[model samples]
Target: MANSKWSHTALLVIDMQNDFILDDGLMRVDGGKAIVPNVIKTVERARQHGILVIWCDGGIYGEIFWLKVVREHDPQGRDVELFRRHLYSQGKVGPTSKGSPGAELVDGLVIKESDYKLVKTRFSAFFATHLHSFLQTAGIHSLVIAGVQTPNCIRQTVFDAVALDYQPVTVIVDATAAATPDIHLANIFDMRNVGVATLTLQEWCEADA
Candidate 1:
């Protein structure tokens, strides 16, 4: 595994911001801040390999996403509408809210001026953003993904990348977390057994470059 061999690889840091990780943020994933060290390790490795690094953050204006979730979950008899209402009133996911300090990238994730920063309107970064085109332009054939909320953004992005014929490797240490350990563990299992290739921080760095 050598850096020179992975010039075409890229690293996608998904949704590791204050809003998703901080306690006061609207939707905080437990242990989100704790994963910073691991994410930093991955970012360093990607940079060392000359791999393009892209930061993907979710954004919303108004109650578009929350309202949709409420409708879908209510159909299943889930009590999500109340929470959705609260989130909406609290201004959680509305219009440039992601630019707030709480939604900014964590302290040490390493976003250099030369790196690319993309704001996504949905869970999957490729859905409504220029992520795919950016990768193609950079000749990126493989991706190393790390971010918050494993069951949401990280999982969606990895799945979407696979659907687009890109090899995706999700680093467990840098990827997902939920409100509880059980939920996080379950998500990791589901993702690994599905399409995404899951690895630890150390394993990912030492893997075939």
Candidate 2:
């Protein structure tokens, strides 16, 4: 597939890290495991369509992508959110700490060489990051998102995408999830209200644009 057709589109895969999606995660997203296959499927479809795949994760270290490893917390978790600081408290390295196994992408999802890796310290991938400049430089204006825990990472990212004027932001409904179906649906509802497009993986893959 010639990438020219999708040159302006990018698929942002967020927070597929082991700590957030796997059975042994430190703070797993309740329904994250079930969507792993769908996320993989979405990545394959994105590649076939020639869309730039951007892998995203939250951390204080290295640039990453499927997701990358952060360097490690300050042992005291000062870099982490106040509520989540407990995760790294008491000298614990905490989940998704740099070089930690939990920061790795869940099994079955991979980040290809051509994909871009981005690390953020907060929920929105664009927050205090070069994501906006990178997207602008890449000439990307449309986004397709797939990932874990819709209410937080996914929702905040989508909202930020809209705020930044990324037209036609789309979320592959089945490829991303939350703690429960009701929570997922409610968040999806709010996104729709703000003009985000919510579709299934199949729907997104088949669309001409």
Highest lDDT model number: 2
Residue 30, candidate 1: C-alpha displacement in angstroms? 1.0
> Which residue pairs clash in candidate 1?
60-95, 61-95
Model 2 clash pairs are 64-117, 64-118, 65-117, 70-98, 71-98, 72-98
Tally clashes: model 1.
2
Give me the candidate number with maximum TM-score: 2
Model 2 CA lDDT for position 76: 64
Tens-digit lDDT string for candidate 2 (1-209): 63566767877888888888888798798889999999889877766666767777311111111223122344467777788887786778787787788888888976655445687667777777788887787677888888877998899989999999998899999999999999999999999999999999888777865
lDDT at 51 for candidate 1? 56
lDDT of 2 at 28: 91
Error of 1 at 63 (Å): 40
Residue 116 displacement (Å), model 2: 2.2
Measured on C-alpha atoms, candidate 2 has an lDDT of 0.77
* Cα lDDT, all candidates: 0.60, 0.77
